[model samples]
Every structure is written in C-alpha cells, then in structure tokens.
Target: MRLPPLKALPVFEAVARTLSFSAAAEELHVTQSAVSHQIRQLEDDLGESLFERGGRRVALTEQGERYLEAIAPALAQIERASEQLRGVTDSRIRLAVPSSFAVSWLIPRLPHLQRQHPELDLDLEMLADMPLMSERLADCFITFRYRQRGYSSERLYVERLFAVCSRQYWNRVRDELDEAGLRKRGSGVTIRPEWLTRFTLLSAASVFERPGEDWRRWFAAGEAKLPADAHVQHFSHMLLAHEAARHHQGIALSNDYMLDTASDPDLIKLPTHELQTGDEFHFACKTARRNEPGIRHLSQWLVKQAEASGWKV
Candidate 1:
C-alpha cells in the first residue's frame, strides 16, 4: 500500500509538536500558508482531519495524536537511514550530548578529533538530558548514567568532581579567611571546607539531581559540616556555573573531564577533597547500529579522547 504524503509527515509532526502553524512554519523555514497546505494535503490523504483549528490556536485531535505517535518514530528512522547513506560518501556522525559537556569538554577538543579523523564530521545537538536511542535524533549519544543498560554503551569515565574557582577570586577569599584569623601555616594557607560558607557556592543543578546537593556532599566528604547560612548561587548547567567561577563570581563544582587544570591557568582546583559522584559518562548508540563503521570509529575515538583527558575509570 502507498503511504500518505510522505513529505507532509514532517510538516504535520512539526505543527503537532508546536501547536502553531506559524511556529511550525518558522521551524521548517516555510511560510505559514505552506504549513497549512501541507497539513491539509496530509489530512486529505489520510481521510482524517488531524488538527482542530480555532482562532490562532491548534490542538491535535485524537486521531492526530495517534497518527503522530505512529509516524514520528518512522520519520526519525527514515531520516537516520538517509543520513547513514550520506555518511558513506562523507563520514558524518551526528552526536547528541548535554550542552555543558559540549561547551566545556567536546568543543575544545574537536580540532583534535578532526585532525585524527579528517574524514569524520561531528554534528553536535545540544540537549540537557540524554536522548533516547529510539528517537533516532542522533547517531550517537553521550550521557551520565547510573548503570549500563543493554545498549551499545561504553563507559567513557566515572566522573570525578572538584571544587574550583578563579585564581583571583580564590586568592581574595583566602585573604579574607586569613583576616578572619584561623588556619594559616607557613607559605600556604590551610583551607577548611567550612570556610566555603563565607563565599557564594555556585551550584550547577545539572551535575546532580538537585542544586546545592554536591556542595553538601563535598563539604561532608571533607569532614566539614555545612553551615546553616551557607550561601549558594544556583545555575541550570555546569557551563553557566563554570562561567560564573571564571569571572570570579563564586566557586563551582567541576567535572574532571571538563576541567583542565594544566591548560586553564585561571581556574584552580581547591585544595579540598574531590567528590566521586558515581556518575558515569557513557558514549552509546542504538545496539542495532552499534557496529556501523562510522559509529564504531566515533566511539573508539571518543574513548581514546576521554582516557587522554584523565578519565581514569
């Protein structure tokens, strides 16, 4: 049997997702009229009105919802197949990863990936959470997972987190702590985690399930009690927290893979202890396509990069 207007499926999906013809048009880079035309054509082909339209608002009818559920995955798979075929001519691996990882880790080392595999081109899609393999939005995914599932996932690193701040800020804080008159020995001033309460703790919620939790754990690990009035500045992602710390705003918890102490002279790791969050960052792909040449090579290259970047686990 012939399929309903295959070209219109994407337009329908986009419109259904956004619930606005104009929004879908903008996303598809088409005029609003074109989006409506495509939806109309699709509805005609399917012999069903997929959307309930009323005065600038659009809602998916029951049929529309069911249709979307069935077609969305198929569309995704078809797109992946097309990309795979194109990848034969040009080795392209579409990668999805957390935005923080992209900014702090992957983007910096991308030149190295290009030099090592001149043929491979990485198209990174930034997301806050891991994409499901079935979504087929990307050829590969990098995620921090609690445990390994049956998918073709390779453990890239067991995350090691450390408290870090700009050298200038750290120095200033140290001076303040010293003036407060407590731990001072020889050339180096001793640090107690309890002193962290004095300055703003930059909390990146993405690192843990909740904001400020990492700081609490970090302090606890150092045998220091969290002060009742401990100040915390919250951010949604590590990149934001890192930015604040770089500007001497506050101290932030940083991931080992993302934190380059040798290369980044401005940001210094605190003398305090590290937190082993048990968070595992994995490079994974759909098991069905795990052995695909591009994915396999990409995975190997990433694993090497992770190891070289001090991912001990």
Candidate 2:
C-alpha cells in the first residue's frame, strides 16, 4: 500500500489550522524551523503546494484546506481512541464563541446546558473574533455565515441593535436634555440622531468597529447624521461597553440576545432607533461529524436557547 509521510501530515495540519508557522510550532511543541522543514518535505512528497506564504502571514492553499479536512477527523478519532485506552473518558466538547455572547447570553444560561446534558462537559474559548474553521481551534464555533466546503453551518441568530444606557444615567441625562430642549417625547420614545452626540458614546470595538462603520450604518438607518466629532469611549468588547453603560459611563449599543429589557431594571432603551444589521450568526462544525451525538446535542440546545431568548433563527 502506498502511504504519505505520516509525520509530515501532522505538521501540515497544524500549520494549516493556525495559518502561522510560529503558532503551529508552539502547538506541536517543536521549533519553527523544524515546522518549516517538515512542511517542505510534505510538499515535496505530495508534489503540491499546500500553503500560500507571504512575508509573516500564511494561508492554506485550496489543496491544503481540502487535505486538512480529509485528515482532521481521522486525527480526532485517533486521539479519542488513544485517550480511551489510557482510561480517559473524553466527553468534553469545546465551543468557541464571541466574548460578548459568552458573557451576556451563553454564560448565564449555562446551568440549563448542564441540566440538559449531564453526561457531557463543555470547554468554552471566548474570542473577540471567531476563527473561520472548526478544525483548528475548537469542536464547534458560533460565528458569521460564510461558505466552508466541508463544514455544516446553520443560521442561529441575528442582531437587533439599539442604543441603551443605565436607567439612573438617563434619569440625570433626561433633565439635562430637557433643559436643552433635546428631549422630545412624541408617540413612543423618539429622538433626533444628532441628539445622541450630547452624551458620551460607548463604542464596542466588535460592534462599533474601526472608523465607526457599524455606527455609521445605524445612524444612516435612523436617517440622522452621525456627528463628525462625537465624543466616544472605546471598549474592546461589547460586554465591557454594556458594563460601562450600566455604571452611567455612556450609551452602549445592545442586541436582543444580550438584553432582556423586561428583566434588566438597570437599562433603558433609546427606543425607535433599532437597527437590524442583517448580520447572521451561525453554528458551524465539520460536516463529517455533524451527526455525532455530542455535537448534535449541543447545537440543538443552543438553537433552542436562542429561540427562547427571541432570536429569529
């Protein structure tokens, strides 16, 4: 039987997964030069270039992505079998999620997950930006929808964004705005978009984004001009922005999944300026393992939880 270089296969998978030689080297507990050499040897043996190397950045070539898909499941199975032989009961499912979602949505409902699936354990890797593939980082990922050839993806939730701030903060700001004739209450809470500039704007880096693109979109949706010099404070994540808003720091943008106005006595909405960004969040996993009991259970539970929380799936 003809076989490929077995040792080189793991090196290729690690490099393709991380898209960084140094990262792959660290993961495999080997030297960076050793990783490069193994990759070269693998490419020589296959007669196909697996990666596109440009300066310090590395990306998998089409061939490499396909090759990784072919091997990743096999590798995972082997690891599982080895663990079992060593008396390790590996029921842990790793889930990668956006940091804000972890804090505001998923973490709070974790007890339900435990009650529903007592046999399985969960390990969460909360990230500001989710990786594109499930093969590299964790077993499953909650992320934006994009076509990945060998992966199964299902739309899980969408954002319903609106401005929010602490009720206490608004109590003070309301009188200040009323004094300035900026508070106009006519038919279910309405405000001029430009009026938002009077108070500090709490910007979440993941939502408000660099150069204020999402913020611009929200202003455009409201048909209000975004101030050229709006006073803005930036937070690295949405939860931090929310926390800041809760403490009377500023107005924070919030989504439906993260906020339950009925339950949260601390927050009040800007109202009537809601913007559905049309960004779809998806649950994704390797297509080959989509039906695995543990993965399927988690995915369904997540969908159910989102639906219960008013996510339009």
Candidate 3:
C-alpha cells in the first residue's frame, strides 16, 4: 500500500483505537474534523474502510485491528530508538584510570589538558576495585602494564617506583645505629637494617602476575633486600597503602608519581635511586576504533602530555 504522510499515522492510530474521532482529537490536541480528515486520508491510501459507524460511536473492522497491532509496535520501536540515540548524543568521553594516578598525576594535569584543548571533553573514572579495564565498557583506559597486546594502544609513561617511609621511622633508625656503635661503620643507606629482621615490608600487587612484586623488582635492581621478616602487608589499592604508610603503619611500595600528595619528608627512597620496572602506563582503545579521529587525538595527546611532564613515554 502507498504510504500516507508520516504525521498522519499517529492521528489514524488514535482514532482507530479510540473508535471516535472526537476522542482522538481531544487526546491529540487537534480538531475533530482534522482527526477525521487524517483518518480518511489513511483509509484512502490503504483502500480499506478501517471502522464501521454505529450509534454515536465506531467499531474497528478486522483490517483495522491488524493495522493497529502492527503500527503500535512500530511506534514503540521508534520511541525506543530515539531515546537510545539521545543518550549517546549526550554521553561524555569516558576514561578509566587507577585511583593513585587519578589523584596524583591526572588531577594536576587535567587543567593543563583542558586549557590546551577546550573541545576535548572527558570524564575520568577511577577503577580501584576492578581488576582489568572492561573493554566493552570503557572508551579509553589508563593502566600500568608491561605489554599492550590484543588492543590498539599507546604507551603513555614509564614510571619509576620508590620506597617511602615516615620521617619518624628514619629518625628511629638513626637512634638505633648510634646506640649500636655503627654510626661510622657504614654508609647512611637505610637498607633494611638486618637481612631478615629489620622493618616491616609492604608490597603492592604485580602488574603482571600474582607475585608481581613492585618492591622486590625494585630491590632486586638495587641488589638489596629488606633486613627482617618485615610484617609484609599487601593491599590492592595503592592509595590505601600510601595512607597506611603515612600513619607510620609500614613502608609502602609506591611510585614516584603516586607520592605527589605525600609531604616531601614523609616518604624516603632507599639508596636514593629511581627503581626501574617493566611496567608502564598505556592507553588502550578498541582495536576497531583505533583509526577514528577522536580516539587517535586522545591517544596522541596523552603521550604528548606525559612527555611534557618529564615522564618517559
């Protein structure tokens, strides 16, 4: 059948269902004659009498019932599609990042990125509780990973992890050494005092495996180990671990960037060298959307920002 004007479908459907042109007109905020005119146009186009006139009312014929059933679902589907498109049109660029990185590095850097690119809208989401970036959910992700396989990705930074302890703890070590008569016997290096009995050891999870010890790797590179059966504490959240360290609870395995919030004297590096690790920050996008301009712009901007911040990208 030939299609009537798109605007007429609602008029025809309302009149057919209500079985009264006046009732349909009242519901649609139109004149009864206008409703009747639209229904007549629809019936003429389809070449069928969709309703039978009764005493001051109307009843739908078989064809009218069938048409109403089909049009009701079609109208419902259109409404749903409209809502979905509206949601997408209003969506912001969603980003997933680690909590420590968000608070320390990204928070400070966001204003700069915004000043540089005012059109680059973004939403930063911290994923402290999640294990991996759920690919289906996130548009862009920032995480510390050694490798970037199975996705279109760009390396943002290679961060150096460091050991941070409270100043009070360092002073205690100085007092202990003076009493031990080792004040002049060794360098002022705060290597955990004994090979197996000095201080508590705290380590965060590895970037790769269960035993991914950021501390052990850093210590190994320095040819050193904590002196004692240091009460080893493992926490999933880097921020929480840092907080624990701040309270003089334990030595936290923290990266230099993560210590941006801690007071300068609160955390101290062992041997005073940057700890090397294979882990690096990477921004990953779906492999299918790598070529899209917005995605590419974001990926490149993140790399450029890292470089500008003196981080190795």
Candidate 1 backbone collisions, by pair: none
Q: Residue 149 error for model 3, in Å?
A: 6.4
Per-structure clash totals for the candidates? 0, 0, 8
Off by over 4 Å in 2: 184-188
Ranking of predictions according to lDDT: 2, 1, 3
Global CA lDDT computed for model 3: 0.66
lDDT of 2 by residue, 1-313 (tens): 8778889887888888778999889999999999999999888988999999999999988888888878877877777788789987667788888887788788998999899899878999887675557455788888875467778887888777888999888877676767787656333457767778888888877774674665677788889867888888877777888899999998888898778887899998875578888788888888878888889999899888888887776
lDDT of each: 0.81, 0.81, 0.66
Candidate whose lDDT is highest:
2
| Cα displacement (Å) at residue 246, model 3 | 1.7
Instruction: Report lDDT (Cα) of residue 239, candidate 1.
Output: 83
**Model 1 alpha-carbon miss at residue 2, Å:** 12
Alpha-carbon lDDT of model 1: 0.81
| Local lDDT at 76 for model 1 | 68
- Give the number of the best model, judged by TM-score: 2
lDDT by residue for model 3 (1-313), tens? 6466678888867776556889789989999889878888888888898888787778888898777756754664465468567774423457888777889778887887678767667888787543333332356688764243435678877777766767676566556666676565446754543431355656666333343366666556667764334467777667767777777776776775676533455666554445767677788865655675666777778888677666765
